[model samples]
Target: MSYDNILALNPRIQAHATLRSTVAKKLDKKHWKRNSDKNCFMLSQPNIYCFEFVEKLSHNIFETIH
Candidate 1:
């Protein structure tokens, strides 16, 4: 099989893997902060900026499927 066909076989997994990898890098770089009370993580920036970044990444990764 070709390289292109690998992602075609499972786009969701591929998209999630891409997102996870990006998030991991950001975490290592201390771009995201953990919220223990909320049991989640937030970016070290304004809410709008964080939302836009995530939205753009998601859009780019899943654009082909959509």
Candidate 2:
């Protein structure tokens, strides 16, 4: 019924693993970026698999699809 509930019910969520750490790098701040437009922290990594960055990225991807 709701987005969080939908995410909870997603089977793929259980298929993968969650990272032990919060951010990729605890001390280094270089892995973060400030987008004047999005105003959100962007993970400086190859894949968007990091859980912290998922919600915004999901909306972005679905925006393109719709």
Candidate 3:
């Protein structure tokens, strides 16, 4: 799956519970740096899930997971 797909799936995974905080908590600074580097990740990317997206997706994913 593409990164967009995975990011899109984030909502399905979150189920609406604030993905930003959840994801951030789950991924420490090191993890973020690694993932970012490996994926050419930019949190500020236009389409990708930035902080706000993560927050929204986390909420969605959390609800769905439960």
How much lDDT does each candidate structure score? 0.67, 0.63, 0.67
- Per-model tally of clashing residue pairs: 0, 0, 19
Score every model by TM-score: 0.29, 0.23, 0.28
Off by over 4 Å in 3: 1-40, 43-49
Tens digit of lDDT per residue, candidate 2, span 1-66?
889998988676377776666465543444454534353445554456556468788989999999
Rank by lDDT, highest first.
1, 3, 2
**lDDT score of residue 33 within candidate 2:** 42
Query: Candidate 2 versus the native: TM-score?
Result: 0.23
- Tell how far residue 23 is off in model 3, in angstroms: 32
Those runs of model 1 whose alpha carbons end farther than 4 Å from true positions after fitting are 1-46
Which ranking of candidates, highest TM-score first? 1, 3, 2
Error of 2 at 16 (Å): 41
Best by TM-score: 1
